[model samples]
Target: MVGERKQEKDVKREKVRGAQDKGRKTERKGQKSKRTECADFTDKPRIFPAEVIAGKPVDISCTFDTTCNGTAPVLTWDTPTDVSGSISNTVTQHGVTLTYTSVLTLTASLKHHGQTLTCRVRYPSVSSERTLILTVQYAPQDLSMTSLDMINASLINIIEGNSTVIICSVKSFPASNLTWRHLNVPMNRTSSNNELWLVIPHVTSRDTGDYECVAENEHGAVEGSITITVEHAPRNLSMTSLDMINASWINIIEGNSTVIICSVESFPVSNLTWRHLNVTMNRTRSNNELWLVIPHVTSRDTGDYECVAENEHGAVEGSITITVELIICCVESFPASNLTWRHLNVSMNRTCSSNELWLVIPHVTSRDTGDYVCVAENEHGAVEGSITIIVEHTPQNLSMTSIDMINASWINIIEGNPTVIICSVKSFPVSNLMWQHLNVPMNRTSSNNELWLVIPHVTSRDTGDYECVAENEHGAVEGSITITVEHAPRNLSMTFLDMINSSSVNIIEGNSAVIICSVASFPASNLTWRHLNVTMNRTSSNNELWLVIPHVTSSDTGDYECAAENDHGAVEWSITITVECRDSSEWTAGLLTAGIMLNLFVAGILTFVYVRKSKTATEERVAEISDIELSPSPLTVKHQGKQNMLLTDPRNTTREGETSAPQGSL
Candidate 1:
């Protein structure tokens, strides 16, 4: 037993040794794997995007390959100044390998642009680091304006007609776009990187306002403004002569005091002055007003005058001219001179001299007409006045004239139209005129020896002889004209076979019918006949139209019309021709027979219905009586202690005080 036990121990010891060797081999493989595991950055820093927008959050991740060694990995990030960021790490396992992702979150700023961000990963056995260059995209900032020639100020003032340039600038990453604006409206400008130029070749009041410099980028926009003021000299200058009667021209009478005023419109107050004949005149100034006064004007003062208004910027001038008139004397004449007048080498008749030389003419007559001269000699000069007289006579001949009426003695006019009659007379002097119609005075208008008689809306009552009479103190004459009023045909009448009062005519079939249309009018009108609005055979005589229908038939049964037309209008008279049928008697007889038959049929039906109803009622009464039982006691009853009787037959019932039929007999 001792030998068997020792052998068992040796066998167990050998098995133990084999187990230990296997355990050692497994541990060695694991150690070798742990030693070979290394963390390496898989994503290169150059792969990251180069640009990022300021104030926007960005996420960047660095990936690494490593092995799991029972310890957590550490991730660290180094960020640029003014850039805030957070780092996180994620580990993913594939078999025995681990992928480490380190994510860095950052809010970028302009200060962070062109800076480096580093991400480092530390593992139990290995470590990795990555560096990335960041380019931060930012909007424009620090917008400002600089004046090229003028003073640099938020509010600037410039002289009118002067050139100026303004530069707009901004500071930004990625180069900002710049523009210029005037009073919130965009201005045309020349632009470059981060700057815009606004060039004004000539500055005027229109350019005075707030000017803005606007800078913009994909991120945002900013603006700054400056005020501009423009100063200008006086403009639209005007000069006025206060003593002149006309505003367009200066004309002052001799010995009259005159004043010239200067006016101007300008941004700044201006000084005003007056000059005459290119020489400065003595003037007075009050505020913007300057006046030059001449106490007594003369011919020497009749010259060009200029008013000048000037300011620091520039000056403007306005000019005017003055004129003077000399007075002259007048000559008079009486008893109407027989001589012609002469003034300034011109011969004047009495009428012309009366106006030109202020010469008086009294009792002017042709026999006293001649050249008359009145001479006045003075030391300075000699002047003469002469005149010739003429006389006017009264009317002599009178005549009538008209355009529409060929003959002045007579005229024909349509109703509701105007008529003009002119009575002309040959006379030197104008005459009083009047119109006489039907021996009664009428109102008329007179001009120069002519009498005008105008009649508007002429009617039948206005037709008469019109006499025009023209008279002056010396003579009188008269003329006459006749006016006739024409109107449309009226009071149209239709006659049948000389029956004048008839309006409509009826003719028998196969007989001739003559229809006459007569109308009342001053002048005979053209007449025609129409059947159903179509022209038919007609004969016209005077104001009458005759429509004759020969052998009238049923086909001719329709309305016929007679029409009459004159210069004024037209009139129509209508009549109905109802042709009598040839079979009238037969038609009447047939109608009577039909009516009789229809009445008889209706009567027979009514009689049969009445008889049937009577029979039915009789049978019903009999049946009802049969249903009643008869009493043997005479069918009697007592009422109010008097004998009252009941009849077996209902028709036999008795009224009060009436005898009843015997019951047995009923």
Candidate 2:
């Protein structure tokens, strides 16, 4: 029994001794790896994306790709400022596939204005720690600009094709995108470092408007705007009338006036003026007529007349010539001789030979009584005789006694006969008794007492003026008388016709009326109408008169007057008419289509109202939630165990403009 007890104690002692040997071997292995492993850890503790955002949140962390131990090491974050707080391990393991998140807020601090933050990780067995430093900085801010305040361009300015530039210099912390906009059009953008520019090609009126620029940063935003304007001048200039000339012989009897006009076509309109030999006559638009009234003139007021037109661009001038002559005569005794008569200051031999000739004066006016003389010359020296005399004209009396002296009568002949009119007058010298028809003379007699006119198959062509003139070695005189060659009107008819449709009758609108002034008459009489309360426009047809309304309205229904007049006399006719209006509802089986259109229009309005209501409801819900989030209070807390205590914040994890809180917080 003693030997068995001693054997059990020895077995126990050997077990205890084996356990101690294993522990020593593990200790030696751990110590052996310290130096060699540290040399193998070549991954230089990197921190990715080191830029700091001012007034915003950022993540702070590093990579640890070395050491494969089961225990997690301690990670310490130390900034250049005391604003940094403790961090926790977001993910935990020992070596492979292990991650950690920061518990402290990575916000900008005063001490870390231009400095950096470093994270150091250490294992319990290692004597030194691995470190990574991240740059702690803020984004750009505070932008400045410089340029001209207002740029004024000239009147007729042009920006040659794509070469117009408006440049503005800017000073900013960071480079920004520059944009330009006009109130007339959409915005255009460009990018530069410290300056922004807006360029335009061929600037037109549409390019003139308000322009703007904007600069922004993580802290805040700022902007500026300006206005641009463009201008233009004028266009399209021209002139008026081309020519104006006075009569060759100014024969103003007495108490008469002459008026002339000149004009120009311009954008702003122009003025007219008449300049006559240093005499300026000003005229305006309303009083543009230049009137020259001569009252009972004897012999004066003769000069060159000129018309000048002026405007903003320049001036132009035109002229005409004029002359005036005198007409006067004085009475003398019966034995006194007449004034000298010069035949255009040239001499001519007498065709009729009557020796011992004496000059005789016949019935004459003041114009023909100027001068008279007679010269007789044989093969010897010439003998001259002169007469300075005054003459007066007497009105011819058409009494019975005068009618016998001057025979005058009318007679009818055959269609192709030669008609002759004779007027034998008894006076000191022969007097002219002219026979005229319609103020125009036929080829009958010229300065002779006999008239012979011939017509070949006479018709209406044989109508109009017929005259017989008589003058002998004195002043000439004329007398005219009209003759009516009656016959049927050429191209005559009595057919009822339509002017508009050429049919017997035409359909018209109830609100409109047509004046059918149709007349089928002889002698081609003129058409005339005198209608009150209705407008008139005479549209002459080949054989009809289209008396049209100025316009067609509901009140165009009344009696109309129609007249046909000729040289013989005038005749009147009358007619009453009614008007009708066009009906817009005269659709042929189209009422169903109109009904469908009205139904669709109502349905569209209902759909629009329903969509508007739905959008309003959604906006109300969003507004209520936004009010709750704006209040600074912690409603929901994310509990990420111990690591989340320093890293998690409600404001940091919320979306922009969204309400992030628990239901109770609202």
Top TM-score hit: 1
What local lDDT does model 2 show for residue 574? Answer: 53
RMSD of each: 38.0, 36.8
Please write out the lDDT profile of model 2 over residues 151-267, one tens digit for every residue: 442112232232355654443334555555556354666554445676665655455556666654443446666555543222222222211223222332222233444444332
Error of 2 at 493 (Å): 66
Off by over 4 Å in 2: 1-43, 46-53, 63-74, 78-86, 89-104, 109-115, 122-164, 167-178, 190-196, 201-208, 214-222, 229-666
User: What is the overall TM-score of model 2 with all chains considered together?
Assistant: 0.24
Judged by whole-model lDDT over C-alpha atoms, candidate 2 comes out at 0.41
Instruction: Give lDDT tens digits, candidate 1, residues 1-666.
Output: 233344346446545764674576577765665534234433222113434788888887766544445566677777866677787778787655566777778888777776777767676666656566676778899887888555565867788889988888887766877778776778764333788888899988888888888787777888888888788888888667644445545765466567778778765678788888778885433335687788877779988888888878788877787776432224344422233345344554433223133333222222332344645443344456444332334444456777757343667788888888877765434677788888788875545677677877788788666767766544455656667677778888776542423555555555555565677666667888888778985544356555656456789987777888877688887777776665667756645654564456446645654675475344222110111111111111111111221111111122222211212211
Best by lDDT: 1
- Write down the TM-score of every candidate: 0.39, 0.24
